[model samples]
Target: MTSSSIAEQVSTFNEGFTAQIGPELSAVFDAEQQALTAAGRPDDAVGVGDQLVDATLLTPEGAEVSLATVVGEGPAVLVFYRGAWCPYCNLTLKTYQEQLLPTLRDRGVGLVAISPQTPEGSELATSNGSLDFPVLSDPGNVLSRALGIVTEPTAEARAAHTQLGFDVADSNADSTGDIPFPTVLVVDGDGRVVFADVHVDYTTRTEVDEVVAALDLLP
Candidate 1:
């Protein structure tokens, strides 16, 4: 059996790290999550059988790459993250890179990660995580906004971020600090969404086995 499931791993980190960081910082983070959850989540977003909308995203190298081009190629999996600054996002992306990318390549499925950070920030994340897939910058959340997953941080959350040294305003080109719901969408060649999972809680993510099972059902 696998040593630990992703949920187990994240739970362990959440418990141990929070303890190590002291209650003050931990409470701030918890409050932030609560605020986000309290803010009504987007319900009219994309769904299974719905076509994934097309948008242009900035590559790490500062070039434009369209969802049109990405979805046209065989099966594609789009992983939308909060930002490289978030530890949970880092862990999730690294996990996907280590566990999901190989099978995706073998199966001829395209994999891409998107975040609302600046292009430079996206490049930093790709390099730091050693991610082989394209890391796209969704500036101003053009795609996220269209998909109805865009969310702005609360004032308390922003203050907590400042305390944590994550100046999202400075790092993101859009300067809004708007982020997605840690979403994953699997699209077929025709741009139809075969699988769509959006985690309102940023601490969680869609697991590797889930992706494998979803891909197995693809035509």
Candidate 2:
């Protein structure tokens, strides 16, 4: 085949492959969401103990903040993310901003959102609206990888992401590619992960009310 024809065939194949993978990924996400919903909330808290992981993350103001220090003050609500580019993460953050932050603050609990996004992207996402809490940037997914929550996307998923114009690289420049499943942890004053929920699905999240109730249980 001619060079032009060969190039055209390759492009066509990529497109077809992307199309095929998109629906499959969507189904996987849907199934995972359903399973998480059916499982309901965990009755117990997360096991972080006194050995809280210490990592520096860039805040929205471009300042470095330590995760352990933040949690050491009092009870803290830490929300982990794949990146600011994710719709589910955005929704989850917004929900917390709207619904959970006030309640948590009333009870003397600090709120923080952690992601692998660069400082610029993290600031942009938070600046778009009112996020009273700090958005921390975890470059290289160093903390997430240490927490055993980092996962690489499959080749097909990457192809589908490219076809869909989703810039995972820009979303998580520091991490290179590893993404974290959306997870939330409630840490008490003693530096323990009091409550934790990590979901395989990106669509579902812990309800804001549920988090408040969990905070209420903490001393």
Candidate 3:
């Protein structure tokens, strides 16, 4: 709604969070982001021209659905996020709902969001964002792991999360901290990825404009 980039919105959130959490906890998160940056994207991570593997994903109601069915013979934008408990995830998803979904709809592209969270978490994300597109549960990161995009919070970061009375495992259906690095992929009707953007830093996200431009370039 604001037309500002997700990066700008996230910057504002980070400033406010730093003000609330103070320097100590903020440093812990900063260290985590730096570590992720140093580690870099996984060598085996899925990319453009790769064919995505189909997997059973859960709906918000706990029913099962196939990834192929979700794609529905059209180009789709797949968003991978940590969970509903993450403020950054919530903000990104809401922004996609407001900004990305309309353009995607007009282009006849499907939009789907996947997370390792349980059905309840998926429901919360959908309701919070008032999203019309499917918000799916990846359970144990089945599809994400297959894509080589899975990662978990470091022990130090996990401790910081605990200090804040939050644990990543608590929201996950697998009862583990495993989550997909914030990633977005544009796949063709045949399920081959045409474009992929992965963010090792959770504070950043794939922008709607970039995604639209990618879609525009598709053959």
Candidate 4:
């Protein structure tokens, strides 16, 4: 198959797979939300000074790296997601790559994307999405859990995933299982999170223009 055909096939497969798994995913998400609410953690609580913690991520080629190193001398935009397996994430990242990255760069901002997927998967995401920014691998969701954003998949969700032929193990070799919900955080030079959006609903995402406006407000 041609590259375009291969990409199309992947896209089609992902779409059908996501649809097949949606009900189980939704159930897990709902249960997690209820648990967090019971635990007094609001869905909208992602923010600054959250301190991403002792998390070491890898570049697409497997080099050890940290978000601190990527956030030098400028404001940084960190896009965190489960993996490239999510279509919503794929679209969101592609939109940022095609639109927001240049606009942010022009305004002296740096863009980086983080996920629980391996470097190989990250590389596939970057290449498939045409992302210019670095895609970092969070391995075991250590960074995600540190930020209080990790959500474990229910057994039903896991079974659904398996049925759909969605291999979390294959996609994120370092991760023990499924990924966290999609999140975005804007951090200033001092490592303070100036802006954050922890999406409860997988289909919804923060807009690029809204991010630009947030960046505009920073010093």
Candidate 5:
């Protein structure tokens, strides 16, 4: 509660990015902001009380893991990220690992991060975050698309990313140029969404303390 929201923290980081990348590359963010106008926000999402789909994902070790099984045990925290190439995603995940994971584990809440990246990229993310929880691959972003959180990058965004030395195709398993919005959904034992934080802006994320507060409210 003493610290800033994850969005606020990342906004500070993004200022650095915007300054480093200059106006033309920064304009891609402008385009993305416009696109978010048509995109699904968390208020319209499968929110508090709506059940989640029991989707399957591939672990970094290439094993198939079921969301159903995870949530069946108790509460689950699902984090959808853009992938290892994204600095914002790494920052969010790392913060969760340091500030959120231990609390969730103590409460018997399962924490998993899902991304449309290859197993290799998942490995990079896990190592980067020093994550103790599962980092799953979404393959073609099938689950995220089903949840109405999927979006394809604009050409300008792609070019800007490439200019920054990040190749989405190299990280994503499908190479489809599509990704999920940064989202965090807390599902209870019955697989219903109790807390949903889906951000239209890629620079933002669900704060760790907020997620813990949500988990505390879980019945």
Candidate 6:
């Protein structure tokens, strides 16, 4: 378990990455984040009181399962991430495995992480993080788009990705760069969202304490 908070971990990674990529490329990423911030949160993003929309998702093994089935008859914490290729996503998921999973399990709440990546990519995420929760693939961004949380990297970012030696589309099942804004939603057994937190910036994440606070509000 990492002792550092997600924000601190992200800051450390950002500093190292910036140093590796140099100022010019780092500026490109900075501009991209600024653009996303300027765009603001999606108006139609599903929020508290909204019912969860059912969608078919793939397990890391490639077996299809419905979102409701994954959550079963209990409340759940649904995490929407970019992909396994994202360092920030990996860090956040790993932290959840260490810090949040025990609390969620103790309360009988399910935890599922979803992304528009291939089952292979999902497998890597699960294995890399040593995650106990279900890591599902949302091929084609179907579920994420339904939640109105889809976004893609800017052209400059894509070029930066090329320079970084990998393309987001390559890891995605949809073969596209589209991804969800990093989001966390707490939904009741009946599928009504009790709490929702969406981060326009990929570097930020919903902390374990925040989820526990939301759970405390549940009936």
TM-score of each: 0.92, 0.76, 0.98, 0.79, 0.90, 0.98
Cα RMSD to the true fold for all candidates: 2.1, 11.4, 0.8, 5.8, 2.4, 0.7
In candidate 3, position 63 carries an lDDT of 99
TM-score of 3: 0.98
Each model's lDDT comes to 0.83, 0.69, 0.93, 0.74, 0.83, 0.94
Candidate 3 lDDT by residue in tens digits, 31-97? 9999999999999999989998999999999999999998889989999999999999999999999
Better of 2 and 4 by lDDT: 4
Clashes of each: 0, 0, 0, 0, 0, 0
What is the Cα-based TM-score of model 6?
0.98
Q: How far is candidate 2 from the true structure (C-alpha RMSD, Å)?
A: 11.4
Structure candidate 5, residue pairs in collision: none
Instruction: Kindly list the per-residue Cα lDDT of model 5 for residues 1-219, writing each as its tens digit.
Output: 225566777778878888998988888877887787665584445567777887888888888888676556788999999999888898888888888888988889999899999988999999987888889899999889878788767887888878888878878888888899888999888887889888887776788878988986688
Q: Give the poorly placed runs of model 5, Cα more than 4 Å off.
A: 1-5, 37-44
The window of 10 residues in a row where model 4 has the poorest summed lDDT is: 1-10
Q: Regarding TM-score, does 2 or 5 come out ahead? A: 5
Candidate 4 ranges with C-alpha deviation above 4 Å: 1-45, 49-54
What's the distance in Å from true for residue 7, model 5?
A: 3.3
The residue-by-residue lDDT of candidate 6 on 1-219, one tens digit each, is: 686889889999999999999998999989999999999899999898999999999998999999989999999999999998899999999999998999999999999999999999999999989998999999999999999999999999999999999999999998999999999999998999999999998878998889999998677
| Candidate 1 pairs with clashing backbones | none
The ten-residue window of minimal lDDT in model 5 covers 37-46
Prediction 1 TM-score vs. true = 0.92
Q: What's the lDDT for residue 129 in model 2?
A: 38
Q: Measured by TM-score, how close is model 2 to the native structure?
A: 0.76
Query: 136, model 6: CA deviation in Å?
Result: 0.3
Higher-lDDT candidate of 4 and 6: 6
Which pairs clash in model 2? Answer: none
